[model samples]
Target: MEGDSKVVESKPHLGIPEAVFVEDVAKYLKEQGSCTCEEALKKLEENYQKYKLMEVNLLQKKQRLKQQIPDLKSSLDIVKHMKSIEGTDTTMTTNFFLSGALHAKAKIPPTKEVCLWLGANVMLSYSIEEALGVLNKNYTTAISHLDSVNKDLEYLRDQFTTTEVMLARLYNWNVKQRRAAKATTNGSD
Candidate 1:
């Protein structure tokens, strides 16, 4: 099994770019010294909004992948079970759904071939060995993709926290700046 498994590289595009790292609030304000605190706050708010939107998208994708992984595993299991019984003389019979609320029974015959449904109303017949290979490849691919999605989600959550912190810090800095300006005016008068 170890020989069959290969390391799949996660796509780099799945995570946020390095350029978007959370900035230090004080450093950001210092760098933008010419701009007023309100402007810096507005920029920070925009960053927060962008992070929120990305989180929404990633959450949706994660939900879909979570649902799909189970289905892939189920299909793989069924195929493996079928392959296991191929050589045994034990006759297999089972009830199958014909349609909505309709059922029929069919006897299974030992054979080298199996049919696989490839979505979009397509089906293909292959030898048991070939079918197993296809199913295994698909299962591995789905598992790897799910792992990538999960990692991306974790990274995105960190980004959300960082952005929220920056927003709060920038807002507080803005308030302090306003208080200092008001004090100077009153004192000068």
Candidate 2:
């Protein structure tokens, strides 16, 4: 998606988000300098669609990231609970659900260290406190990433709205000029 749509920020327009520079807007405007009203309208519509596409993609990515946050935070909480039960024979049962249906429960190993699934089919042995630290760090990082994505999405929305407004203004201005010109020409005859 990133390769499919790119918004180059050479210079941002007024009232638009600083993070987004609709270079196409400037390019099209420059091209329309010598073109007719219809041509300028076409250019504005084309540029408007591009920004809209960007907004949609950003929204999708932000939603996916948001879904992951809850799961990651849940894991962090479990590890924190394990940290609380550190020494004593807390007798915790681990449950696994396959395909969101079948459930299997088993007793955790009777040892001070626990196995942590570190992704890519890899598992590592770590003490309860160590596991808590790792999960906490992961949750923190995920949260930070989510926040960044949210901020970007917001800025993208702002840019989209600003561009749309600018295009509408341009269209209205063109229509008014054409109307006034027609009126003056008709009166002269």
Candidate 3:
């Protein structure tokens, strides 16, 4: 009911049939006898139980999914570690060959170029590691936020559904009461 007005306004055409059906049901209930209230209450209780079961099943599934997040993080960490080591090996091989070539040419070949290459490799490695760290941090943060949001949504869904069931039960009871009163008055006449 929180956003009922907005929903009604948003789907004016689509809601027409549903509104008509509701009106028809109301009219039928008005003609029912004394047993209508009890029938309506029973129907509401049954619907509440069904919703309760559905909520429980969905929450269980959510919990299982939440539990998998840590495992996923661990697997990602392992992959990052393996990749870093592979990068270091590749850098070392390249440096070894480059440095050897520069030193082989005596007469004191300028080492600036070799130094630049080595410096670049170091910077690249550092950047890669830093990026991985940031990625891991972000992954954990996102999972944490998702878990919290899912929990809050589950609570709200259950609350709203329960309230709806109760309201429906009350409305049905009132309609039934009206029908019973009319029936008694007509019978007495």
Candidates arranged by lDDT, highest first: 1, 2, 3
**In model 1, how large is the Cα lDDT of residue 120?**
95
Error of 3 at 7 (Å): 16
Question: Of models 1 and 3, which has the larger TM-score?
Answer: 1
Model 2 segments beyond 4 Å from truth? 1-40, 110-130
TM-score, cand. 2: 0.68
The lDDT per prediction is 0.74, 0.68, 0.52
TM-score of 1: 0.78
On lDDT, the candidate that comes out on top is 1
lDDT of 3 by residue, 9-124 (tens): 75432122111123444455566555365575565566556556656665665676576567557545643654555523332222123464563322222121111112244622
TM-score of each: 0.78, 0.68, 0.41
Q: Residue 9 lDDT in model 1?
A: 31
- Candidate 1 residue spans exceeding 4 A from truth: 1-13, 18-26, 97-103
Where's the lowest-lDDT run of ten residues in candidate 2? 11-20
Put down candidate 2 lDDT per residue, 1-189, tens digits, no spaces: 675454545323322334323344445556657776567667667767766776677677768768877877877776666666667677668787666688899775345676777779999998877887887888788788778767766766776676677667667767787899999999999
Q: Which of 1 and 2 is ahead in lDDT? A: 1
Top candidate (TM-score):
1
